[model samples]
Target: MTDLDYFDQFDDEGTEDSASKRDSLPDWVSNSNSSLAAYQAIQSLYKEKMQYIRGHSKKSHYTKKGSYHISKSEVARAAGLAKPNAIFHSVDYASKLTKELNDKNALLVASKEKILLSRSSSIKDLSKKELQSELRGRDRYKEISELKADEIVDLTLKRLPLDVKRQLYLA
Candidate 1:
């Protein structure tokens, strides 16, 4: 569909519900008989929607379950797809993403530890403002935290940029 046609699908009067604004399934997804494809499509749609909402509102789409978190299953239900089993291939993909995220956080933690350890004696001589200024800026911190760790590693290794390698402390 054309851009104008796609935009016209939304109600401008603020009378329609948000669900009405979401685009309908394309022909391939709508006509597919494969449950796996349908499930994947649903997951893709949820990922896109979550990204959009979080980008605008600075909010997460996760629902906390004790120490764990999960997304709502309404996206799958709306797409008429059965939720995949927890042990399915998609679970592995999710686990990998989570692991990468954790690894990235761990790297940041290690970086902080290294800085603190190296500056232990001199840190007391530095003021809070000086220390803050020495660290990565707020925007850069947010950008790095929001990035997918695997993607960051992939780009760094693929491009082999000297500055990036130095910043990441890659040998």
Candidate 2:
């Protein structure tokens, strides 16, 4: 049968409620199907409706439980940002967070490059005292690097949702 034949079959066997599409399928299919074809066959409707609601390209990839699958409307509703007559749009928080990430990325690159260049260059050429002094400098650099890494980690932890922070404390 042609593709249209299968389309007609789905339209006939379908339930009226919309959430039954394949994206919400149990994980067993993902491991067992071996075909990687659930989204096209079952979840396509949710993807299509979601795309139409949000203007996603018709051909965009939709992964199950993956990064692209995040639903802003659902998250917003859960966060209690949904209004009886409106949708919440919070830009400042995301913008500030993006700037922070960009800053961290740039700083980490600079730090890594500095450390690599300092360590990778030959140390054999230095006199004993100079070599010892350079070793001290390397120790200092390593300490600073650890501090910077800690700073990054602590900042990341600060951004964790409240429950995660509480669990971290209990652990």
Q: Best-fitting candidate, measured by lDDT?
A: 1
Please give, for residues 14-83, the per-residue lDDT of candidate 1 as tens digits: 7756455334433233223443443444455545544433333211222222112223244344445466
What is the C-alpha lDDT profile of model 2 across 48-162, one tens digit per residue? 3444434322122222323233243433443344431222233323433233334443543444344434543356534577789988999987875778777878767877899
Badly placed stretches (over 4 Å) of model 2 are 1-91, 120-171
Q: Relative to the true structure, how large is the alpha-carbon lDDT of every model?
A: 0.47, 0.44
Off by over 4 Å in 1: 1-92, 120-171
| Clash list (residue pairs), candidate 1 | none
- Candidate 1 overall lDDT versus native: 0.47
Q: Considering every candidate listed, which one attains the maximal TM-score?
A: 1
